[model samples]
Target chain A: MSDPAPQVPPQLAAYRATIDNLDAALIHLLAERFRCTRQVGRLKADLHLPPSDPAREEQQVARLRALAEEAGLDPVFAEKFFTFIVAEVIRHHEAIRDELSE
Target chain B: MSDPAPQVPPQLAAYRATIDNLDAALIHLLAERFRCTRQVGRLKADLHLPPSDPAREEQQVARLRALAEEAGLDPVFAEKFFTFIVAEVIRHHEAIRDELSE
Candidate 1:
């Protein structure tokens, strides 16, 4: 990666360094989240559980949207992000279920 | 939201429920993440810090990609995810810096 411009304002560069640091934290958090969910997936597979719960998903989306608005973030964007994460989770659970059934 | 099929395999339905629950947990975790990051942005604004750090960004990308691979996820996808999150964080930081400057 190219170095941040040497002559650019130091403050701007510092801000970016902090942002990058936080982004790394986020990735680690996400990995931890997926690991926990993977365990849940395995449990469900053992019990022969379905891979999606429409009602619960709806409730969560509504709840998170409200929280997002309260936080001054765009509710719609938060909803979209949640949806994407949930979809990925469902996909993983489905794979686990298939593996267990076979 | 439509109910999961009544006649569908109970196991599949159970799996979906678990997945939904896990997804909800993930949303809460992400919300918490953003909250902490927002505080960092505010601090940067107060100090007049820059909003992008190329070297640090590169380091974080490499770190996250490795973590993703170790977690059985795609490194490339993790990189993209980090890139997206960093961009968003930078945007927020820039806005905060502008507000303070003005």
Candidate 2:
């Protein structure tokens, strides 16, 4: 990586550093999230359960949207983000199910 | 929220609980991220700097993608997620700049 931008204002640089740290934390959190979901995927595969649960997903969307509002974030944006992550999880679940069946 | 699904396996329920907590944590983290970005936005406005920095954004995407690989997350997905958040931050920055100009 290149050296830090010396020309940037110190306060701005500090904020960017915090943002970068937060972003890294987010990636690690997402990795942990997938690890949990993978276990769930395995459990579902063992139980011969369906890969996707529409009802549960709907409930989670509503719950998260409320939480987003409480956190002063836009509920719609939160829902979109949650949905994106859930889609990835479901894809992994389906892959797991397929592998187990094969 | 509705009572826990009694029919769900305990293992599945536990995983779900962890997932729920992680999801909430993600929301809060995102909020904090925006909080930092907003500060940067205001600082940029105060300094009469531009709202968006394409070069810095490109650097961040590369940096985050590398970090994602280190964290075992899909680098492509991480880039997409980061791009989405940066887009929102830029929008907020633009709004802040507009407000200050007004």
Candidate 3:
């Protein structure tokens, strides 16, 4: 039997490699972003600020959705993706604050 | 000006809708899972357990990677995806413990 056709083009191999590299870079960037978020949590904790800031999260979701659409990604998928990230960040911030207290 | 071609096929529209519904359900399930993780965190905190259980996390990553592969997803992507989720769950658990303390 003949082998199945290739899903991706040979010419696109380089592009696919670039995407993989970018994905790795994105992980590093996300880690850095989490580090900054930890700092923000520290500040918030110091000021006794509430951990869940709905307004700020909404604004962030809107901004990221727009950016993703501009970058030619599905906006709905981007929104869901960032929602998970933001939720995680907020949780991390809360955890940091908890650690600082003890 | 010519209209742009449809990107998704009509037959796939129902499938896409099902995916969207599943996505929403997945969010709900995740939230429920977080709730359970929070309870686990509370128990851990009561028992004076450390938040970072590297061994358990490693096992989780391995198991999920296998499951994702079985589900026909890119194992690497699934690993990264679950890493994010696990991190978030830990953070949430910590947060829940913090709140319980106050």
Per-candidate RMSD, Å: 6.1, 3.6, 20.3
Error of 2 at B35 (Å): 1.0
TM-score per candidate, chains pooled: 0.62, 0.89, 0.46
Q: Write model 3 residue lDDT over B1-102, tens digit each, in one string.
A: 776743433433443354333334344434444444655666667766666567656765676566555544445755777676667657766786677678
TM-score for the A-chain in each candidate structure: 0.86, 0.91, 0.78
Chain A only: give the TM-score of model 1: 0.86
Judged by lDDT relative to the true structure, which candidate is superior, 1 or 3?
A: 1
The complex in candidate 1 yields a DockQ of 0.22
Give the 10-residue window scoring lowest on summed lDDT in candidate 1 chain A: A7-16
What's the lDDT for residue B24 in model 2? 94
Lowest-sum lDDT 10-residue window in model 3 chain A: A6-15
Report the C-alpha lDDT of model 1 over A1-102, residue by residue, as the tens digit: 887655545654564465555555556656766776777688767766677768767877897788777666667767877777777778889999988888
Better of 1 and 2 by lDDT: 2
Sorting all predicted structures by TM-score, with the top scorer first, yields: 2, 1, 3
Which residue pairs in model 3 clash with each other? Answer: none
Top candidate (TM-score): 2
